[model samples]
Target: MKRGEAAEDFPPLSPKACILSSRSGSRMNSTELGHRLIRHYPFASESLLNERGIGIYVPPSYYRDENKRYPVLYMHDGQGVFGPNPFSNSSWNVHRTAEELISEGLMEEIIIVGIDNYGQERLNEFAHPLQSSGIPGAPDIICKGESYERFLIEELKPTIDGLFRTLPDREHTALMGSSMGGLVTYNIGFRNPHIFSKLAVMSPYFVRLDLNTLREIPFYKRYPGVNNLALWLDIGEIEANILVEHVRGVVEELIEQGFVFGQNLMYYEVPALRIPRRIGQPECDRRCCFSSGSRAKQLKPSCTAEKKSD
Candidate 1:
């Protein structure tokens, strides 16, 4: 199956009408597994796009250490990340997962922002502009990716940095997403290297676009800000079967551009883990921390990390 084919078919959603549990605020109220999940409902923007929700997961140390600051991870597909997202009812359960990891000392404490996707507009917002070489099954998507990128960089990011105690530098910042979300994560990370240095692109829907067109994007053409990045790229066993060539093409290009596979750039193929949320379990979380301009750790089982030699 093409990436995000299942999510794209779901009905459109109005931002105000979705996730109505709380009001927009500076306070952190929601709780899961001893961590705070703050809900900023109807997070309005100056742009024409609908007002979306923001789910912020503050680490356990957030309250305990008023003087301490944590790194931030900005994630796409906000709704389904922290808990049962409104879309698939399957969530990344990031709150619980991160709590476990922190307690076990597997990963450091960081603030995770879940930026909600605009339901039906997800395909358009997350997609990169493709020429006539778009994939056969992929729809003709008008790339609002630039606008979405602006929302994260221009709007939401400043708000989070100002309100929360974040490191606020490119080295301490990261971006992660799955499927279509994954596609945008890589795009935004590459384009805005000064903003985010760590990237976890899980089951990226790169197969939706022609390999040649993808290679022509700025990161490939100019290689700007890529070397400063610690990128974790992965595809599911099933998805890998379909996108092996496309995924491999991107990996090979990154290698050619001086991304040492097991060191700066990490690539993996996970078996029996297809669901995007499940694909982002603790293992991925651990690697994300390892990628966050910190010491690298050994990868876990069931996930294959490939090292490419120049």
Candidate 2:
């Protein structure tokens, strides 16, 4: 096996064994009640940020087929993924959307892991001065994004791989998030291309930052072109004009660095998303194919805006 690749015939740990390894974690009900969502509460970390619960959504065929291994998508904002978000009463309905796509044979069956954000510390955990020019309603200073990165790459990924039957290679692994989470996904995806090959960055919080700030970001400084990485960048149609311009700027920058418009890079202006703050399930539905190794151009033209800009 390669550095990140998993053995095809490797056996998965029993659910009881998996739960026992994490002293602070508890296993919730599995496929017993037509529920495929698994919750591991207080998923303790070794030396990173505070421990938080994580939601893992196994595909419909996960439990039935013991020998099969699937790709994994690690998403931020776990609480709002499968269920309604407490803050806005809206959700991405990721599990529902994934099941639909898989049933229709639109994408491959994959595991979706939602990592919950630390409530008030979300900005501190997701935002970094090097990654952002400023975090609205918060001071523009250093943050613990590096620690957050270590938590995901070191603690979370390893734990998930050990517990689940996952195809843990870079090509099969992806990172996804919206807003601040989107910003960090973009940061982490490019910085560690060896770990993650796909990124779904919806409505990233680029704010009113200028190109100079974006150019100074560590990923841009280090990577001339992330052609090996697939990225999906988008914004709500009702969002502020500045945000649209910000995403456009980032798209242009990525293009300059060798990211093709309809190949590995995708930019969209989602008109169906009426609420600027809420992440739409349709967008999640569209991005499902990305995890299955589809190109960005395969997404619906109703949401894609690459031709207009080019």
Q: What TM-score against the true fold does each predicted structure earn? A: 0.78, 0.80
Worst window of 10 by summed lDDT in candidate 1: 2-11
The RMSD of every model to the true structure, in order and in angstroms, is 9.1, 7.1
Query: lDDT value for candidate 1?
Result: 0.68
TM-score of 2: 0.80
Pick by TM-score: which candidate is best? 2
lDDT of each: 0.68, 0.71
Best by lDDT: 2
Question: How well is each residue in 27-78 modelled by candidate 1, as lDDT tens digits?
Answer: 3234332234455445765542566777777776675568999899888888
**Backbone clashes (count) for model 1:** 1
Give per-residue lDDT, candidate 1, residue 38. Answer: 52
- Candidate 2's displacement at residue 271, Å, is 0.9
